[model samples]
Target: MTGRKLFKSAKFQEVNTAVKKDGAAIFVDKEGQENLIIDNPYAIRYIHSYAEDTPFFLGLADGKLRGTKCGACNYVFATPRGNCQFCGETTKWVDLPLRGKVHTWTTCHFGGEAFLKETPYNLAMIEFEGANSVLLARLKDCKEEEIYVGMPVEARFSPQPQFSITDIWFVPAGAGPGQRSKK
Candidate 1:
C-alpha cells in the first residue's frame, strides 16, 4: 500500500457458497482498471519418483554430496548422472569434495515459489578439484559483487532435510550463516 502495488496470480475455481469463504483478489491492469479475481485455494500432497537420482537426495540429507563416476572411462561428474555422456557407460556414485571454487555465477532477481523469499540471491556453478563438471547451487553469505569466477566456497547442509536441492547451499570458504563478505 506504499508507493508500490502488489499483484499475484491465484487459482480460480467455481466457489461453493455453502463452504466457508477463502477470499478474492483485485487485479489492476495497466489501464488502472480493477478486475475481481476469485481465489479458491487448496492444499495438495505431491509425490515424485527420483528413480536413478535417489542417491543424490539421500546424500544431501547425510551432509554429503554425491556425484557419479564412470568406471570404464574415468569420467567424473559434479552433477549426478546415471550414465556417462562421454563413454556411454553406467556410472557409480562418488562423494564430491565439500569445498570448491566458483566456475561462474549469477544474481537471481527472480526465482521459483520455493525461493521467492530469497529473491535477489546468488547462484553459482561450483568446480571441484577432481570433478570434471560443475554443480549448480545457491551461494550465500556473499553479495553479487563479492562473487567472481574461481571464488572459494564450501558446502553447508540443512540440519533438517527435505530431500531437495535446497537442502545444500554454499558460502564463502570460512563464512558462517548471516556473515557477509567485507568486499
Candidate 2:
C-alpha cells in the first residue's frame, strides 16, 4: 500500500499521531513501529524502583558528605555505587570531606523546567580532600571569572533540606564548612 493511502486509512486515524516540533509526524501500526509519545513525562503514573543512594541524601541533611568504599578492593566512590567498579564487591558507607578542589567545571546556559529560574548556573566535578573519586555538584556563590580548574571549594547545604543532590552545592573554599546556600 502507498504511504499516503495507508495514512488516510480509517485504522490509521484512530491511532495516535506522534508529531515533532519540526513538523514530522508518525503513526504506529499494530506492530508498534512508531515511538510512543507521552503527554506528561514528569507525571508519575506508576512507581518504579528507587535508587540505593539514600545514605548520601541522609548525610546531606545531617550536614555531611557521604561516599561508598568497596569492601573487596577499597575503591572509593563519590557517587555511591552499589558495587565496586573494579573488584565487583559490595560497598560500604564512608564520610567524604566537605572541602574539595574543582577538578573541572562548566557554566550551564540551559537547564530543566525546575532549574529554568536558576539558569546559567555552574556545575563542577569536585575532588574532595583525601578521596580518589570526584563528585559532581552545583557550584555557587561565585562569579564566572572566579571559577577555575583546581580551585578550592567546600560543600554547602540548602537551609531547607530536600534530601536530594540539590540539597548540596559547592562554593569557594575558605567559605567555611557546610555553608548554607545564599538564595
Candidate 3:
C-alpha cells in the first residue's frame, strides 16, 4: 500500500480525532472529548530531533520491532541510537520480531501532563528476543496484578500525527493480538 493508504487505514485512524490548524492532531477517548494533542507546535519543535530515527519509528507504526546495528562491530543498539556505542560506527536500522517479555512495569498515579488524563495506567519495559535491549512503553489491556516480569508481550502502535513512530506501546500477551480492548 502507499504511504498515505498505510497511514489512513482504519487501525491508524483509530486513536485520532481531528487535525488542527497548526498541523497538530487531537486524540479523543470513547466519550468523544479531546484527550491529548499529538502535535503541538511547541512540543513538536523541541522533540523533532527524536524523529531522526524515522526508520525505526516507522517500523513500530507498522507493527514491527526494530533496532540499530553497528556495521563495524556488529553491535546491536536498542532505542535507535544515531551511532553505535561499541565501535563508534554509524549504525544501520534492522527489523526485529514483535515478540518479547515484560522486564518491569509501574502504575503512574499522578504527575504526567494534562494530555495523559488516563492516570494510574501501567507503563512497562519490554525486552525483545535476541537483543540486549528494552522498550519503555505503556502496557495496555491488562491489570496491574496481571503484569509480571517475564510475561510475554507484543508491540501495538498508537497513530498520532506528526509524532515519531516510536509512539508504539506494549500490551500483555494473551490479551488478544492486534486487538484493542475496550477501556
Candidate 4:
C-alpha cells in the first residue's frame, strides 16, 4: 500500500512500482502479483575476449573451415576449443575438412525472430571424418525427405558473412567422401 503510481511511459503505462531497501523495484501486476525487477538491466555491460576462438571466425570470413587439434592426444575439435578435452593440453588451429556427414538432423518449425523468417529449416549435427567434435550447422539446399543419418554434407560459406555461425551452413555433398576434393 505504501507504493506510489510512477510516471507513465508509452510502453509501460501502468508503471506502479515500490522501492525496496536495496534500491530495487517491485512491480505489482493487475492481479496483485509482486515481482522484483531491475531498474536498468541493460545498464550493465561486459567485454568478452574471444582470443582463443579468433581463428574459427576468421576462417569463416575467409571461406575456410578451421578447428583446433590437440597436440598431446591428437584429438580434433570442431568447436575450436583452446584446450583438449581428453588430454587437457594446448591445441593448435587446423583447417577442418569441409566435407562431412549428417550425424543427426531435425527440422525447426518454430524459432526466434531472426530464424523465424527461415522457418522449417533443417539443423544437423555434422560429423567429420577426422574430427571428434561434431559441428551443428544449418542444413540447406536439400529437402527434408532426402536427409538421412549418414547423408554426406559439405560446409558452405556465405559470400558475405557477419562473423558468426550464420556464416557457414551445410549442404548436400557434391560427391561422397572418396570422391570429394582434398582441399
Q: Find the candidate with the highest TM-score and give its number.
A: 1
RMSD of 4: 7.8
Worst 10 residues of 2 by lDDT: 1-10
Give the poorly placed runs of model 4, Cα more than 4 Å off. 1-49, 175-183
User: What are the clashing pairs of model 1?
Assistant: none
In model 3, what is the error at residue 10, expressed in angstroms? 53
> Model 2 misses residue 33 by how many Å?
24
Query: Which is better, 1 or 3, measured by lDDT?
Result: 1
lDDT of 2 at 2: 25
Candidate 2 residue-wise lDDT at 169: 91
lDDT for residue 47 in candidate 3, whole number 0-100: 29
Judge candidate 4 against the unseen true structure and give its global Cα lDDT, from 0 to 1: 0.77
User: Which candidate do you rate higher for TM-score, 1 or 4?
Assistant: 1
Off by over 4 Å in 2: 1-42, 45-51, 176-180
Tens-place lDDT per residue, model 3, 14-126, is: 53434333344444445555444454445433525555577776666666677887889876665678788777888888886676888888877774586367766788887
Could you tally the backbone clashes for each prediction?
A: 0, 0, 0, 0
- Tell me which of candidates 3 and 4 scores higher on lDDT: 4
* Residue runs of model 1 more than 4 Å from their true location after superposition: 1-44, 176-183
Per-residue lDDT of candidate 1, residues 47-115 (tens digit): 889999999999999999999999999889999999999988999999999999999999999889877
Q: Is 1 or 2 the stronger prediction by lDDT?
A: 1
The 10-residue segment of model 1 with minimum total lDDT is 10-19
